[model samples]
Target: MNRDIAIMVDLQKLWDRKVEFEDGISHHEKSIAFWEKKISDIRKDVSVLKENLTQAELEIRLKEKKVYELEEKLGKLQKRRDVIKTEKELAALENEIKAVETEKDEIETVVIEEMESAAGIKKSIEKKENELAEAEPKMHEDIAYLRSKIENYAKEVRELISQFNAGLSKLSPEIKSRFEKTIKSKEGKAIAPLEGETCGVCHTSIPVHIVLEASSGIKAMNCTNCGRFIYKKENV
Candidate 1:
């Protein structure tokens, strides 16, 4: 099998670059979406408040209609009192008028309270809508900026891949294939440099005989601990 340290290094570098670009793009998109969701929530709140105000206004109108009906009935009762022939009939009519007036007074109080509530709700709705309107433009700008950054990052990642491929082509075909297999299995990390007779990739001591074999470069060697191909660097 081909075991080329240079090819492995390039592949590892490319993998790191790809991961960095992917993570950056993901973070940027998430931030953009988060802001948009906040804006949407604000808009929804405004709509709910508007609906509440409308309902309150409708309730007040109904109450006012009831008050008008009460006034008309009270007027008719008063007229009857002037022309009534029986004392018992007049007393009943007066009692009815008093009861109607009391009910109307209670309803009017409720109507006033509802009017105030409706005004407050309308104000709240307007405030939230204005906030959302101001925020929407900022959100759009943020999303556009993120998209631009992602585009640039993708270009960088592509350039890195091209460089990595060029580095691999310099290796012997057999070595290239072997390194590709090992690196793929180990997640783009292969051909680790030996440190003080220890496998740097696996952090395990290499046998004296194996260390000598790696130095000679007659055959490929791997770390017994992690099974990654080993390369010996000349200097520290």
Candidate 2:
């Protein structure tokens, strides 16, 4: 294990932390989107309720008009009751009047039922409206907070990346390129650390001959078990 490799592993750790912060920011954005979509869906539901109420009212009005026309026909038929008409004709008119009255009654019942249903729909719409009114501002606030967090996290990542790159520039090009390649290939993981006398990334034990060479920190060493470079850490 070499000191330069250790430093590369430390840089990878910083990169990992940077990714974690970025992921947190992404999570906040997704949360904001979820709430926003919920609010939108609720509003659509409220709009549908309103349309339902309007249609229900229209149906009630149509039924009421039918009842009114039936009553007018019944009155006309009753007026002809006293007219000198044939017995059969008067009977027919009476029957017609009765039928109209029955239909009018049925229409009135339907109108009443429709009106009740409309009232229920109106109540639902009102409740939904209140819910939307309360939710809209809160959703907006949540989105704003999420956006702010994302922006702050982005700024912090930029600063960290600048510092990381500045540190990387101090190393040789070959070592830096190798570290970058390994970091990318390992998904931001450290290439090496001591894991119970073996390389954490490579799972290889250090031979006594190479152990001193690695511990001396003169050059980077590759693990025999896995090809990942090994680095020595003083604290560990």
Candidate 3:
């Protein structure tokens, strides 16, 4: 019974180490994912800013063309006014010139606004690009360090599994099955030490006879309340 208890204890200890290492690896993986997401989002934002600048430049060109066409029409009307035969024709030509000039003025205003917007967009793109450049190296370094830690954890877990398997081989089939079931139900704790008259894990009082039997270490004893195998810590 004592040998079985020893086997279970050693197995549990090894399993606990495996869990610890695996949890560490999981934590580092999450950190790496977070950094990757940040980099991707920054790149996407930079792309959007660049697209906005391109669109603004195209709009500016179209507005400039409209202004040039309106100005050309105004110039032709002004030249026609010199040959006008009546006051009405002269007035009509004046109206046409004024209309064209007004339209050109509005288009020029839009062009100026678009140019300013393009400048702002360009500046924002530059700032975002710089930020991405600075962050990429640091993020990559951190990811590499995290990956190294995961690799080390994986190596240690493999070693622990080998030790656990060696310990497992010493246990009887009946005891091994019982231990597996207990660990599954009890969150990896298949055995609990006796604490005074109670089970250390569940803090439930044990029968006097059962506590005495467990203390003798004559056989492995189960706690009545929690069904965990009981061991005497001092005897061990």
* lDDT against the true structure, each candidate: 0.80, 0.79, 0.88
In order of appearance, the predictions have TM-scores of 0.78, 0.84, 0.87
lDDT of 3 by residue, 92-201 (tens): 88888888888899889889989998999999999999999999999999999999999999999999888987887788887887887777663778888889989988
Q: Using lDDT as the measure, which candidate wins? A: 3
lDDT of 2: 0.79
Q: How far in Å is the alpha carbon of 212 misplaced in model 3? A: 4.3
Q: Who is ahead in lDDT, 1 or 3?
A: 3
Q: What tens digits encode model 1's per-residue C-alpha lDDT throughout 1-236?
A: 23465456556767677767878988888998899889989988988898888889889999999999999998888888889989899888888989999999999999989988998998898899889889989888988998899899888878877777787788778677776676667356767778878987778998989888876655767777777777676544
Report the poorest 10 consecutive residues by lDDT, candidate 1.
Answer: 1-10
For candidate 2, lDDT tens digit of each residue in 1-236?
A: 34476567668777887888889888998898899889989889999998998899889888888888888888888888888469899878878888898898888888888888999999998898899899899888889988999999999899879878876776677788877776667356546665646877656686765656666667877666765666666775
User: Residue 174 of model 2: what lDDT?
Assistant: 72
| Cα-lDDT of candidate 1 | 0.80
* Clash tally, candidates in order: 2, 0, 0
Worst 10 residues of 2 by lDDT: 186-195
